[model samples]
Target: MGRQRTKPAPTPPTTTRGRRTRDGLILAGREILEQRGWSAFTPEAVAQTAGVSYGTFYTYFESRDDLLHHVVRSVAGEMLAASLVSPDGVDDPYARLVESNRLYLRAWDRASKVLRLVDQGAAADEALRQIVHEIRDFYVGRATKGLRRLQDAGLANPDLDPRLTALALGSMVEQVAHARSAMEEPYDEDTVVDHLSRLWASAIGLQGAPDEGWAARARATAGTASD
Candidate 1:
């Protein structure tokens, strides 16, 4: 009797080569968004940049929108993760808030082009809009929790609605960071951080608290600017 034929093993959905190819495509897509803006970004361009066939690009991303969504999620996830790292010796709630905002601004500055593309894409696409809102809500949620803790500790304003205040402050920082990054005239990073920290502290009723570190840095920055 002839030996029965053996069935071959099924191919894995995520092999090493597949992951490399997928990551290359994401990196290429980010580059395209940075150099050409969202309007000019296309699957073909991403494939060319990634040095992969157009078919390979489709094997990973269904469409440009899908690719954009992935890219936004990737960068935003990294930013959020980085922002979660507590600064050394920073026990004050206000200081922690300032540090988190500083980390976020730095992250936004690093990925400003991709973020801008995401912002632009959200205007016309429902999927992108959802992604944008998801990112915003993630930050706002964290802010809300932090504010609630502060209020419970009798630090933040008792009358302020934590959720609404979080949303408003988060929006203010997001818009200001985006605008400052887009400005032709370079803004002082120290000054922006100092002022924003002070504003947030004041809004949360922590204005009179000792923020000596921030004050010292701001003073040094002013002295340097004046010299």
Candidate 2:
């Protein structure tokens, strides 16, 4: 033979279940974060937990950070969606803020490790930093817009700065999440939500503890729907 022929490598079979496999991996990764923390996370661990081969993990993600990127995006999406857009829908500013605070607490409680990993990664990786920033900016933009609306409607003080308020609220949420992650004490959801609501309320110029009716209602509804 004057010439030799070479065949291309065969493509790996992955997620014969398609998106379900990737979704399963993400779910498994979240479970790992919750159970083992970031220090214990690895591709091998997640693959074993997901009941998929190591090759399968690579098929869905290039690396551990890649899988974590997906998890953080999903968590951020859920948190943003749960934010209150209008106080009128909740009866008052205090109620609305409390509800929003509660939602943030729930998201943070479940995603604390993921959030911490994102922060740590962002410190070293430009791409990850940008992704984290985009996620924060999206939430802050929505909050600023919502606060502007409240101000225009006379629910928020006319003299209040929406941008600063948005940043303040975001900081408050992140700080509480960081605190919970640092502590080993088992505080319940209601306790966390109550404290978060008070923090947010006091930051926005509210004189006392915020009304928690909206938060209670949202928690009850979320529980019922999940059931």
Candidate 3:
């Protein structure tokens, strides 16, 4: 099976007044998601934020979950655009890997709050968990395709399964970035990008794979894993 395009966001009302009201509700929902997260995101709260009657929210959206479907996908579209890199332009495999990681990390950092919310909320909330799964599948699908392309061109490791490798590496970077989002202290962006790029490039048998100091990445494993 191949990847499918993401469905477009729910269209706003065609009339000027209707459009304004619908757009207002979406903005309110987005503000809540970005500021307070899923726990505080109620249909009533959204209506209040948008200065509309509670029933009016329903007129614009079928339910809270329905509104969330639109709002989250809208935000996800921005993240997707931010992370996009033109593979055709980069001739050097290492440079392409580094650029890809850099763009992804940047986009992830911007949505750290929403990412954390989705990750932590997924366990208890099935409806909310779909947001996390959708995001994951979208990224993984693109990455798997990219990996297969590299392998076909003999630029990546032919020994590994592309989908499995995509899942593993995707999880690796996402987990690290999720953890970093929790810290108050700022990290060295350039250093993190270069380090992560090496891990992906090295794993895929891309040229200039790191030869040493790679296994020493477990520096915090003993202490961190216990927590």
Candidate 4:
């Protein structure tokens, strides 16, 4: 009888060392983009900064755009995490909205540079543009839910469409945040927060007078975050 053929061994899974190398490359790429902007970002520079060989970069990322895609996703994840706020204890709808807006602004400020790069890259690449749209959809969904809750509670305008209003609010906030974060002129964070919160309150038809202390609370929260 003929001897049975042996099955080949399964390929090894990625080891801790390989994972570390990939993470290092990604971190290095982010640093490069943050310090030198997208114009100077390159796979070679990232590999060199990460102390990994050029071939190692290929082992993880297919191309420069692939690496950048990972970076954008990572930054977007951070922004999403930062934007999440629990309004359980906050009794006032308008106050909750203020806190939510403040958190969004802080997240945007933290990731402003990377977000700008994403915007530019998205404009030039379809894949990147899809990623940007996904992020926008996430924020819009959150806004829609919040508005719906307000409407149910009789705090928001009953006639307004939640989804449409969410889209408009999201677009306005994102553009304003991007512009303000990039401006060279020093601007007060509290003032911006106040203006945005009040605008949202008015647009949503929030009941009762706007809380005058929301800006101070937002500033205090921001200070704590920085510390």
Considering every candidate listed, which one attains the maximal lDDT?
4
lDDT of each: 0.78, 0.72, 0.78, 0.81
Q: Which model, 1 or 2, shows the larger lDDT?
A: 1
lDDT of 3 by residue, 113-216 (tens): 76676667679877668777888888899889988988898877899999899999999988777767777536677988887888888888774556434455
TM-score per candidate, in order?
A: 0.81, 0.71, 0.76, 0.83
Over 70-101, each residue of candidate 1 has an lDDT whose tens digit, in order, gives: 78887878777866746464886766766777
Instruction: By TM-score, rank the candidates, best first.
Output: 4, 1, 3, 2
| Candidate 2 structure lDDT | 0.72
TM-score of 2: 0.71
Residue 22 C-alpha lDDT in model 1: 86
The list of candidate 3 runs beyond 4 A from truth reads 1-12, 184-186, 209-227
Residue 92 CA displacement from its true place in model 2, Å? 2.0
List the candidate 4 regions with Cα displacement exceeding 4 Å.
Answer: 1-13, 87-89, 209-227
